[model samples]
Target: MKRFPGKTMGLLWASLLVCGGAAAAENFEQCKTRLFNQAVAQGVAKSVATEAFDSINYVERVIELDRSQPEFVTTFPSYYSKRVTDWRINKGRELLKQHQPLLTRLEDEYGIPKHYLLAFWGLETNFGSYKGKMPVLSSLATLACDKRRSRYFTGELMTALKLIEREKLSTDAMVGSWAGAMGHTQFMPSAYYRYATDGDNDGLANLWESIPDALTSAANFLNNLGWEPGFRWGREVVLPQNFDYRQSGYSNRQSVSQWRQAGLTRPGDKTLPDSEVSAYVVVPAGHQGPAFLAYPNFRTIMRWNNSEFYAIAVGKLADQIAGGKGLSASLPDLPAYSRDDIMQLQKTLNSKGFDVGKPDGILGPATRAGIRDYQIANDMVADGFPAKQIMQQLKVVQASETSPN
Candidate 1:
């Protein structure tokens, strides 16, 4: 969950990379040879480097995944519903009670809450049910050889080799997602080297085989990521009917008192806490969807996975595992826009000189900004949400059309 940049959903398809077409590189043998030599140069013992290389193979599907782009961006409702399930919550609660003594100790030592740890544990591999089966060295080497992210992944591959060399771990024993994230927490090699903990005090930080190691390592990871000790990740809040949509984003930071004064209230119209902790408004699904007063801890959660949807899921799951209720607001049914429709919208926005960058059909920040600008210019709601009316007005779709896609 921590350093496989972009979406963590890559874990889902990472297994598909196990077998496929031949290497797309000019010479895969040469690629492996170079990687082996580079590993040796990076201080991995030659024997260990050779052993690692012997286990390495070209995972051709990783190349395709690396170069591919998402067509349709997933909505918050879709994402939240999938991860924050009743079963997951119940399981997490069961685990929390089962490990209460250990979790309480971790919270005391690391200043991280027990429920948040369980949230991370549940989200990143579902309490160790599956931590991927892709060969770590092969996948890292395959990605390192690719020109797109060669430099960064080369460093990661080097780190992985170093980990193998240091720990004397068998290459066959080292497996993870196609992106090379390992163990229950989906940590990259560097994270393992830096933050892996021996919570059970058995002397080794074995994330794959030890629950204590995995959970404690996760706590250390979050602690180092600047988790606010006592604060909740964030909470769903109600925006006033006349709340300005333009002020709704991470860029707009204000205190709880300030937001309370600006008409941000709790779900049941309860006033916000008078405490002066800083928070920002994140309308992840835009104005019509649930809004949250994302605290500093929310930013820390982003450091874990770097996705608003992921962070929201973690926070909400933690809340439920601690016996809290669900979100008060119902998610509005969004227009089922295809990749082509969004791509066309992006093109339209760019043509009008809104600078949404190249159209990739993903509703990234720039596209949201472009939509906001267009909406504002047209005297529309300017929520930056790419709502049905906005897309239709932009001619990305016809007003008479209803999508079943």
Candidate 2:
């Protein structure tokens, strides 16, 4: 899933005004009118566009959500814990058994394991207990007018319009997430248009109501994304006490043999299984945190949802669903950095010429890389994870009051 911006809703509302009087002055209905015309120009039938937009209202709540995804503030451990709870795990197991025949067929056809499919299904909508209730058309339309990511959401809105026409779905029935991701496996409009399938062979890819269709569509997506068969996403591993922290990250790919030679082992000090598969070490938290030896399939998971924490949670949850033990090491309770602190850290790094990109208060790859460079320069563990210590060291703050003991 895309990580949305995280700032005060007031700031987002103000951003519209800063674009000049025309945009700032436009009301919701005016933006809706323009979007409807755009839809018609883009090949949607005028009647279809009109009916879809006729009663659609701008969803202010959706805008608030789009500007505040949790990945920006929550640590990986916290995210993982909340997402991969026992309730979810048990529910996944029950659903795995309940949908075994259909899932098995999907697995055979698409080469994606049933557990992974179930994990995605569970995580996406909690096994369909709560597929979002917001009207998809209105949500997409509202975002299509929002300038933060207007182009992207505009395309999604068009795709959704096309999907309704092609699938013969009732316009009023098209309800989903605030971002317009729909069905049991929360697929975006483009993904739905491209990959949704009639797994039950009922002549309709009814993702919203059909478990078979939803699971099959999800499986088809992974299959198209180049999901490697017979490969686990990755493993939680034990690093040697003197292991080089600089070697951590998705960019540092190495063969299992090389990794073992460099003192990487499976949890409990077992040697990495002999294989030709190339993998990377990802230290999401830092040197003091649990490490993972992520494989190629991990990247495929990242394609499904770009966040490393999301991918890890899915992989681990799938493993547990398949009767494997969870992580061997406990996640450390790290210090929490507020949005202001992150923006200041990014500003400081940029000012020092580390190039963290514009300070949006999101700890993305560029910010992490900048932190790593700063850490390397200062003889600190270059794990790239932000901390109170790093902030103080860079003189971005005077003290480490938020440091976790």
Candidate 3:
């Protein structure tokens, strides 16, 4: 999958690329025709567009993977364990030394640290061990013909065609996740079009083949996403026993000194950095879980992946690879939720007048806020995390809800 929720282009640019929102109802052949037309209309040469179409087909598995994307399904521990492993950290440390010269240059030029770039690489494609094997053209085309995200995927499909024409890449080697995110860092075609760099002086930015090119392109993307030079992503903190959970969360940002005054301290009870940097406290696994005071750079990580779980995983994995202390608190064993379970929670919350704004199974500020409000109203802890107890109270799950098979 690609980094999502980034502002890749303007509404006008997207509108220009999209002409097939209603193509879902049409047969694959018909939708394919519309897509080829849209690609040509967006300035992809007709020859290039036709060649791409000849190699594309509707992939049933792509649509299945899209509907059940791990982003919408996995819980924090499940996501973290799989992503921030010892192998990735150990390998990343070796890579840091192996590519020292290039990484240093990239940091000097792009202001993104080597560890962060490496962290993204480990998380995105396991340090290039597996850069997915799905056919990119077919994946994007299938998604473009779907009703749910046609406009967005249609735009990506058109850009993928442009990338092929520009790079003269073979469709066979241009494989990626079912979502059409390509190469080592899993960049969508739009991101590829914008930030790809020719780091190896190969006269092309081939993210799939050139390690230098992929790393440099990743650095460029992070810099564009607002990475701050010489700043840490965030740090784990020990919250006061009587800390008010309501004050926790991204929206309720406060100065570091203010948080220090409010009894937040480093993991060993050391005083905070004493800076006036604006920061927010995030208890990703809830009040019982660990806490981190997120900084501006943390939001920059979120731009790379809007999911708080993924962002935190990136930070923790980077720290581990750098020989930093791991989390002070062990992750509590929690039940993993399927989309249907979350949808049920949303429906239940709406019935009680929380109005979570139509739950699409993805956890966001609205759902967290709704859960917080509901908890407060019912005289429960207002940490905004949907623990199993709260789930039972809301009747979103059974007495023993386990993960989906």
Clashing pairs in 3: none
Question: How does each model score on lDDT?
Answer: 0.86, 0.86, 0.87
Clashing pairs in 2: 1-305
Best-fitting candidate, scored by TM-score = 1
Minimal lDDT window, size 10, model 3: 396-405
After superposition, candidate 3 runs with Cα above 4 Å error:
1-26, 69-73, 338-340, 353-355, 359-362, 396-405
Estimate the TM-score of every prediction: 0.90, 0.87, 0.86
The lDDT leader among the candidates is 3
- Evaluated at residue 321, the lDDT of candidate 1 is 96
lDDT of 2: 0.86
lDDT of 3 at 381: 80
Question: Which lDDT tens digits does candidate 1 get at residues 346-373?
Answer: 9877877788999988888889888888
What ranges in model 2 sit over 4 Å off? 1-27, 41-43, 68-72, 350-355, 395-405
Return the lDDT, model 2, position 259. Answer: 90
Give the distance in Å from residue 227's predicted Cα in candidate 2 to where it truly belongs.
0.7
